[model samples]
Target: MPEAHIARTGPRILVFSTNPISDPGIDLVGSAHMRYQPGVVTIPVPCSSGIRPSWLLHAIEAGFDGVFIAADGGDCAFVPDCTTRTAKIVDTAQKLLTEHGHDPQRIKMAAICSVCAEPFVNHMEKFSAALEALEV
Candidate 1:
């Protein structure tokens, strides 16, 4: 997949990752170079499941188009019947945003592994698409 490009005037995105995200996640280095543009930032988090609602809200209020959360869920997978906390938190946050008239799609989460580059990139693409669909 090609790197996702955001026009200079477009709303930016803050990607909060719950696991390691490598450079190869993007299709090319040239595209990767554009990452620091006004519209994109990648932040590493301990776990996507544990991200707080307050943090998400802060980003939204700061003019970010959206927040994309990706987590290495192998831990959760190994612990069956343990509905992970991060998943629940993200869902709760989405609901809260909707109640306030904001498009809940602004907050998104995906279960992914660092080594599985394609799925991770796909999630980012989907998140970007959703943000694009928002009417601001």
Candidate 2:
């Protein structure tokens, strides 16, 4: 019997993560020996809420299939409403994507804690699948 081989066909993704929380969680993905797409790249930021919407759009225009924002949520040391502010940023980016004739769903935001390696991997897999479906 021969085993079937599966190839990864998803587009590359850009992740903007909060250094205090989501960054550690992303690191845990490696420490746990989890496997995500090799094309997944992460950029650590002081806070997800501080990311300008234009940056997200730029990522897409730069040929990334998707962008994910790992927000600090309520665990942000810098702000009380991290989730809300981050969500607003995502909303603005989504609109920008739409204005540029792209699908807004190409961008996503989620609350990822420092210990959330599994969740982060799950999100990556799901986002990759979604992007493949989009074929953009």
lDDT of candidate 2 over 35-61, digit per residue (tens): 788889999999988999999999999
Clash counts for the predictions, in order? 1, 0
lDDT of each: 0.63, 0.93
Candidate 2 TM-score over all chains jointly: 0.92
In the predicted model 1, the residue pairs found to clash are 49-86
Model 2: pairs clashing at backbone N, Cα or C within 3 Å: none
Prediction 1 global C-alpha lDDT: 0.63
- Per-residue lDDT tens digits of candidate 1, residues 1-136? 5576644755477876654433234323235443323466777765555578777777887788887666545544334432366677778878777776678889876665544455655566666767777854
Tell me, by lDDT, which candidate is best: 2
Native-to-model Cα distance after best TM-score fit, residue 81 in candidate 2, in Å = 0.4
**What global local distance difference test value does model 2 have?**
0.93
